[model samples]
Target: MKQTEAQWQSTLRFAVGVTAAFVLCEFLKWLPSFLAAALVAALLGNLPIRPPAKVAIGLLVTISVSALGAFLLSVWFRGMPFVMFGLLAVWMLLAFHKMLGGGSPLPPLLMLICLATIPVITLTAPAYADVLPIALVRGMVVALAIIYLVWLPWPAVQPPKPKPLPPPRETSTLRLALLATAVILPLMLVFLLFGLADVLPVMIASLMIVANFDPRAGGRQALALIVANFGGGMCGMLLYIALSTTPSLWFLAGLLFFATLAFGARISAGGPTAPVYVIACNAMLIIFGSSLGDSAGSFSLWVTRVFQFTVAGTFAVGMMELAWHPPVRLLPLRAGRSSGSSPGKT
Candidate 1:
């Protein structure tokens, strides 16, 4: 596919960023959380976010949300399934609503807020009460700072933005949110009750598809979104294993840089397959790399992470298909009625 000048420039900046920011972080041994890279990728990948100030403000708000979520989780959320479910439902609405307007640099922010609020990390964190807020605030600041350095030299200009998506029907947003809550709440309850350490990916995949998808795309598209996340997650797991025991942090960082560059190039080129690859790489980088600088993850834990993600992914995709009713069909359906139609086709 022919790439745009903007595409080329965006990819170049990202590739350079992968090397510079990640390598420097490794060398300095800073920001020991996956949230760091995930946050950066959210900013770097959103090429439409021109004039760095918008990105800055969005990130600052995201940081605040993350800290607050963490603080709340630390203080409460134990043995309170109904309360937790209610809170998560609200979070899902806030985090996923931007989809009605197309993309937002804020999905990652929402993802962070959800993940931070969940008991997954808080239950296990050491002095988590004290460290959770500090760690999150510090991590967001450092990640944003690194990203800022990477973008500093680029001459900023407000690029011509795409027209905002026509407001999605209120019914559509409400139904989608309800469907997501249905899919996610049960799975989250199960994971939480059972003491799972890695429920992040599952919730991430569920809400992400909701937040990421265009309303016109329908249930088949929902399935594809989940598949991409699963594929990316598997690749991410492999990378996690590779970096798990590497003796040299610099070597690990170099490998990460090259990997990031490849993923960023795909994103820049807007290749059909780029999203899966890029998402896979980012998922792995955040999961494994975050564990590296602070906590010690084990073989059993890694395996559980993969297994539980599979269970959660299947649940999310399956339930969403069911929730959409008429079951995502092969032949065309009525036009302009619901999310299932393929606009303009007879």
Candidate 2:
């Protein structure tokens, strides 16, 4: 397929926008710098806002909830297994409740809480109170960065959007809880029971799979995530080896720009498959960040990350196959309707 002009424009905008945001994050001396860079990308990618007001609402809600939930989960449910299960149940119900509103920012924020609870609470629960302040501040950075990036003159264009599904359901709610549980529960249990530390990659991979699932598309999305993440991880690994000899902030930043442009170009040329770059670029960045200063350690981590993403993607796909296998009854208007109909038109 020939690359359309819109797609080419989108590539340039994404390349420019993401690289610029990442470069600016390098200068946030007050915060943990790499974490800020990585998360700035994250918050921007997932941001579900179109207007300025909702941007503020989404940002505030995501940060406040994640930061607060992190602290609370750590203190309240750290070592207790039954208590943890209860917490997941409650969160699942809360997600179901909020998702009923469909257009509210709270549902997205709420799921982020589910994912954030693992990283924030799991790593810092008992002995790491000092980190919460950093995380909270980091949340602020992500919030502000998202808003700034959204309004950038060269804005990243989203690919043609998939049809939006309707409001929540028992199946959707259960699937939400299922995906979160698959990542969070096992990691928590492992941490509580035996104490392991490398769950981050797995969590990220599982998240990529779960979040990208579209009932309308079925198994193909999961397969694409698994492949793209693996390929991008290898790409990042190769980049890491080449760059580590003379590493500097400027060099890393420049590489990020060019690498992003490459995949963004592919999206332009390759059609809808372009957005798979999210999984790919995310893997590259995460691997790049992990590989920053140590050659031996980076090599070891490089292999592990690829394997973990494979495992996580497969696990999520299997879980969804069992839990939410779909010929989902989309809303009346959304079903068998042309693209002209507005989503959520009841």
Candidate 3:
């Protein structure tokens, strides 16, 4: 028993060490210098809370492709709204194909599109260049951190149990698109109201995709996000207040790094709610100066953020349920196969 206890402690220590390392690396520069969202998406692609590898790979490819398409549309259509809309349609079609599969090489396809579009979009708005790089870097760092802490520990190697192939005669894809559209509309309104219109679609789409792949886990995660954001936000506010006098670049970097690490750990553990934590931590780091500026302004921003998340989360889950109606599935078998299984069967 004592030996077992010691072993458990050792394992925990190792996990903590890993988490700390991730935090330190992220904090080295105060802001992540990589495509943080993409990295996060990649990390999500491998978690137990996520879809099977096949599904995740598809989603990743689609998002990368779609993002590229959006960028290209912005450039080519510059002033033509209709052309931009057409591009969105084309992008969505390509994303669907990639996600659904068409015998294309996955990594190359994704990399090609993402690379092509990112530069075009970035160049279109020179002012965005500075902030965009920072956002991308931060996204990449967070993603890598999540990957190290969540995915590396337990890789997914086998195919998931085949879902009951959607009814032969049912039009599931159409239903999914309709559901997503419905969710997106209301979500857009809410975000616009909160002045977070830019991020609203991405947030809503992510939640919808995640929930579609695994509803129960997604639901739990949605709740986790809400709670985490709330807690993290409160913590962020406190930290900001406590350290306001000493707000150096290093301090900001350290806070973001550690907060991100903590968020990643909680997510890995399947903690009750992580979104809230993520929101709170991010809010604290990003808006640390709000308090110094104006109390009303800070409070308004806080309220807006909370409202934005609430709207996004609501739309995500609601549309996911309306669209896919994912059933609860067990964790994929570990060690390659189930016990007493034959070579060909799980």
Candidate 4:
């Protein structure tokens, strides 16, 4: 009973925190505002306990490095596609390798986010490229600030730390990183070649899918990711419509608070599906938040955005299936075991 109460408290805390973060982002009119809310959600979901002050510093440094690295790479290799891709691939490989080897995912994920967004934005909008690093840094600052503010009122009860698992072998980490790189690089190349800057959401979704992907879980996980993304899209659609009718920030805040409460409940429930719900909520936030100031925020565009996410999800799944094949021997072993058991049953 005590545990259940804690869960409810956590859920309520998350809803309030994220909603406040989103509202602040809107009021401040931050560039790429969805990012601030999304980061807050990620932090709240992943770190139940309050993080050390160094975490914010570490995040800032990571963002700075990634942004600087990407900017330099784009400028130096603007004329050499092959060289640019090669370097980008190397950075991705390193990031993925670190992530797979039990390093803090934020650094690698941030590296990927910067790698994905900065270069693409540079290619599509050179002027905006200079501005994005500032925006990213600002977003991280706001997110961390919100996290701290929220924690003051609703401090998380620190759970007992589990024994750390041994890191994966270098070979295994390398293989997984290569696989991840393979999955994302193509999409990055597609965006860069076609200059599909407007459809950046799809690329972002692909990055999220690839970041959380695990080969051992296989096709089921892939499908779950797709479904979760769509669930988020549905939430975003509903919120968009509600805001459209009322067109008031208070109304938007109230709607977001309630909607997040629903998602936070599922997240705090503690099951395999909890992660799925997290992804859904994130999708909803990104979709809904980004659409706020757009002039062409029509129903058709909204539906198209959802469809774009679906395509991104489907593509990631297809890539996963192609890249990750389970051992055929396991299938036969299971079949033989079943056959032997059947005879005993008879």
Best by TM-score: 4
Candidate 1 global Cα RMSD: 7.6
How many pairs collide in each candidate, listed in order? Answer: 0, 0, 25, 0
lDDT per residue, candidate 4, 75-149, as tens digits?
A: 888888789989999999999899777756777887888887778778777877777777777778888888788
TM-score to true structure, per model: 0.74, 0.72, 0.50, 0.88
In candidate 2, stretches whose alpha carbon ends up further than 4 angstroms from where it belongs are 1-9, 24-51, 96-125, 129-133, 136-143, 146-150, 155-183, 265-275, 293-298, 322-346
Better of 1 and 4 by TM-score: 4
Which prediction has more favorable TM-score, 2 or 4? 4
> Mind giving the per-residue lDDT tens digits that candidate 1 earns over 1-346?
6656666566656766655555555566664445556556656765444436666667677766766775575458656746765776676555555444345646454554445334555654434445545655665566667666666664343345455456545447667656665665676567555765555555554454444444455666656666766665666566667775685766676666667767776776553344444555555555555445546667676666666655666676667666665555586656675676566976
Instruction: Candidate 4: list runs displaced more than 4 Å.
Output: 1-3, 158-171, 326-346
lDDT of 3 by residue, 1-346 (tens): 1323323332332244333433443445433222343244334423333345575556455544545444555556656745554544444444433433323333323433343334333444444534433434344444444544543444433233333344344445444444544544444344334543234223422332332333335456555544544454456566555556686656655654555555545433332333343344443433333333333645566566545554555556655654555566789776646675667764
Q: Model 1 — TM-score against the truth?
A: 0.74
Ranking by lDDT: 4, 1, 2, 3
The lDDT per prediction is 0.58, 0.57, 0.43, 0.78
Worst 10 residues of 1 by lDDT: 155-164
45-68: candidate 2 lDDT, tens digit per residue = 454233366665665666566556
Candidate 4 CA-lDDT value:
0.78
Whole-model alpha-carbon lDDT for candidate 1: 0.58
Better of 2 and 3 by lDDT: 2
